[model samples]
Target: MSAPRGWRPAELVADRFETASARTLRLRVADWPGHLPGQHIDVRLTAPDGYHAERSYSLAAPFDGEFVEITVQRVTDGEVSGYLVDGLPVGASIEIRGPVGGWFVWDPARPAPAVLVAGGSGIVPIAAMLRARRKAMADSPFRVVYVLRDPGSLFYRDELADEEIFLAYTRAAPPGDPRLPGRLTLEELREHTLPPGPEVTCYVCGPTGFVEATAAQLVSLGHAPGAVRTERFG
Candidate 1:
């Protein structure tokens, strides 16, 4: 398939801290074509020496006019992530091309129940799906399972408060939290997720290992292999 038009200029109009190491940047792109939920953009940064660095970031919200949002997680020794999280100023400029990827996207018209499994920064696209659903006022049910290192690492905490989210804290738990700190177990997964059915679709995104393991668990729980979709990133 053909790709998006050549990189267009984008300017960071606003930003907010999701965590100490992650930030959500809102960019206004020239001639933006708009994007579906779960799509991503390729961002390019050029230095004074004419060096160019590029990275892919998932859209963090549904389409909004000529503006788009992406959440960046700071990675140690990462060429693009580090600058996106800490170095890039609010008004700085970059180039972006996308609305990339057709699969792993949620359609508001489809009534199938959705199961979203997200690990760390993988929640960005999933969050976009949720936002899109709300914007469309669709009645399709959605269940979200987010895995994080601790309470402090949770993204979009305020916005997700009323959503049906099952959070698993791996390394630490806040005071009064019921679940203990540990990796998500199969038993816990079964307890939180919907029973596999013909009309249910599962979307898992995260690190490669996490996505693979989670998808396997879903299949083992009787979910059809084709019904389980996944997207993984480093």
Candidate 2:
């Protein structure tokens, strides 16, 4: 439960996507320590006069080794994502503290049946959980339902295309896509048929409104309240 050692950002590299909305930043730190999947790191920026701002971003890469990968989605007025997407460059340094947070982490040693619900940028941490699951060969049962506006805006498309995975689009449709279209509704969730018992753990993350609505729907569909765990990002 202790905070992972903090490190200074030692380098930054840009990864441009076909869509301008998504970009991956590879951050290198000086003596960066390892972190469990689903843990997040804090990035802090300061003004010339030393006034500061910070944000917590989940690690997107697998937990195999050194360096951390954080995939950031630009928010309209977000200081961190705005700078990370448009201004920060390789070799730029910043103050970072983490791997912080405990409630959302997915430990390989204790994998359990999991249901992950992500909306938009909320997929960051869930992606890391998947990586850890794959690496550890954890027998934890898994199902992910990622709700996004459209296919073009999806964070990790190909990596989550398994039959067990479901993508619910609330906005535009994906061509030739057979998955459901529209927001995730309580009825739809019930139709999907979750782990059919009380043993499943549901993890939901997204904007505040989405998390609340989804958690409500899950509970309404007979999922035990104690079995549902959530994290919200504004």
Candidate 3:
């Protein structure tokens, strides 16, 4: 693909804490063109000495509005995410390079049943799809299976409660735990995921291994390989 357009300055207009380790930055990009759910932007930060560090993060939902939100998970020694999630100030300015990607986006007009799966911080993009679904108020069914260590670690935990989303805790559990404190099994995945069909579109995002594992399970459950879309990070 060609290089992204000119780096647009996005003012950090708002922010909120999602989890202890993650936070959201709402940027108001000047002259911004609207972006689809599941797209991403490359954020660039510059220091006083003119050295720059950049990282790409998926655009979280509610992006159709004037400002877009991107959630950052602080990584130990991560040059960009660490600063973004823990230190970036509201109203500060950063440059962004894109609203990029096409295939992973959810098209509201198509109106298919959407199966969204996420592992840990990978929930960002999937959250966008959910927001878009809400904004459009379309009748297509939507389901989610979010994998996190515990309830406190889930992104958009409050916003997603009323939706048909399932949380899979891979590590610890909260009160009245359901799965005996373990990783998501094939049974849980099968039970939560909608049966595969042409009218269903499955989107799975997470670390490389999690995406691979989840996509494989979906295919084994009879989802067409082409019907499942995935995005991953290291």
Candidate 4:
């Protein structure tokens, strides 16, 4: 993919969601270029006196060549997020850059059995991966295990209702759900059946602790360290 025409201001057009806590922001860029799944853009906001703050957000929707969608979670003290949730509005303008970062991207051409592990809002990039996979009509072996507090907070609730997805809740239990009750653990992961072979690739995204612990567990479970890719958000 070509580089996005450098950083520029974009207009916020809409914000809605599959759940309340998670929101998808639709931005109208001047040029409206395409980006790879798993990439992020840098958002910049300025104070009245020119003091500025910035944050990097992963794209939640597939690159459609016309608009960009970013999923944001409201963080208690997060400057960018707080502004986005409260101060920003439809028709608001914001400065953003990229189509940046490539370490976590999924390429349909090199499809492999993939295991996606997400915690909280970390599912953003995984959502992009799903869209990309579907667009390519690639039957790449793939499965997603999303861990959250409860259904009320699941980022892409409706999208994940499909049979191919799995949920692990740490706080509230879904009625008749058979998966484990607590946070994801190596033991529980081991109990779940996975496709055979060492070639299976693992993609993990979430808070720092969850990503680190899960990657360690995958390595110990015989998955190649090289095959286990990770992206962590604080």
Candidate 5:
């Protein structure tokens, strides 16, 4: 599959709910150019009256064939996200243009240790990087720190179970877990994330506030400013 130049037709082939408000969609794009880990795609939906709604979603997995997967987080009153999460049916058609973005991607060839920090649905792209790393059989050390409102809101729960992942719950912690429910603290970052160093590359994604705050924490811990890469959404 080569990357299509503009918007191309995508047919929904599979769909599943990852959380109460998030759904993963698998679409087969005939001309889909494979995407790098951490790249995103633009999805567009058109109404019968010529109304259009568009949104960008991060790729959820490494490209294997003509299909691409995206996990959509339903916003409170979001048009595109709402439809993609709840209304789009299997076999339906949508337009997609992508493999967009380059700055946030992870290259398996890099030998530096990776620290992934995700908030809410931000795990979508991080999961792709993790999957790509495994697919490539890279030996670089990788760590993940994920923060969500509760256990129920965590995406890829089953898929990421065996990875080197740490969790921080904001509203509720699972039974037997020692940490109480609260926002991610600097202490947690210091304890769970890779030690500050030049050879460590950090990727942080989530809502704008979370990305900014987490990046600041990493810098405060002595990581070089240029070594930290970030992507943010609502």
Candidate 6:
């Protein structure tokens, strides 16, 4: 329950474009305290004139004392995201704070089934949870419902795939796909998501509207209200 560590200089050691509009940055911080799956950090960029632009970004990978990874989706007029996604290159130093947030995290050791739902770029944190779950070799099963505008827009598109994840396309389904092109509906949610039960832990992250609807649907499907944890973005 203690506060996360303060801002420290983080050097971008590597970066790659995930999509035309999004990029992932690999930062090497001097003294990272390590982080849990689904936690986030505060990134600050200052202009030469002392103007500050700060934003919160979810950790895109699991914790293991390696370099920290944060995925950024360019916001139309967002100063920080714009810089991170398009301008930041290797060796750039940025001020980063905490591996923050406690309630919305996943602990691999916990004996519970995890139902993860992500919308748009919200997959960043859930991707971390998935990585941790895979690396931990835990027995707990994980099922994911990832909603994206299209296949090309998926972050970590190759790593997280079918068999465990149900990719839902809202704007357009991949060529010849049967799934309709629309936002995730409660019907689709119930069909693709787990059968709600007391032992299942649900984590839904996305834009505000997506988070609200998914959480509500999970509750309506018989899961405990307390078991559904959510984080909203944008």
lDDT of each: 0.91, 0.78, 0.86, 0.81, 0.90, 0.87
**Candidate 1 stretches greater than 4 Å from native:** 1-3
Local error of candidate 6 at residue 185 (angstroms): 2.0
Query: How many residue pairs of model 2 clash at the backbone?
Result: 0
Report clash pairs, candidate 5. 2-33, 3-33
Candidate 6: stretches off by over 4 Å: none
For residues 27-125, write the lDDT of model 5, one tens digit per residue: 999966688888999999999999988899999998767999999999999999999999999999999998888888887656458899999999999
- Over the stretch 121-151, how does candidate 6's per-residue lDDT look in tens digits? 9999999988887788777878899999987
- Candidate ranking under lDDT, highest first, comes to 1, 5, 6, 3, 4, 2
- The residue-level lDDT of candidate 4 at 210 comes to 92
In candidate 4, what are the lDDT values of residues 1-234, reduced to their tens digit?
Answer: 566566788888888865654568899887766788888898999889999899999998878766889988888888888788767889988888888877788876666678888888889999998888888888877877888888688777676776377678999877888865788877767655254367677888999999999889888888888888899987
Return the TM-score for each candidate structure: 0.96, 0.89, 0.95, 0.91, 0.96, 0.95
Candidate 1 clashing pairs, residues 3+ apart or interchain: none
TM-score of predicted structure 2: 0.89
Error of 5 at 46 (Å): 0.5
Model 4 CA deviation exceeding 4 Å by range:
191-199
Global fold similarity of model 1 (TM-score): 0.96
The candidate, 2 or 4, that scores higher on TM-score is 4
Best by the lDDT measure: 1
Model 2 residue runs over 4 Å out of place are 5-7, 13-18, 196-198
Q: Write the per-residue lDDT of candidate 2 for residues 96-175, one digit (tens) a residue.
A: 88778777777777787888889998898888888889889887788888888887888876677653667789988788
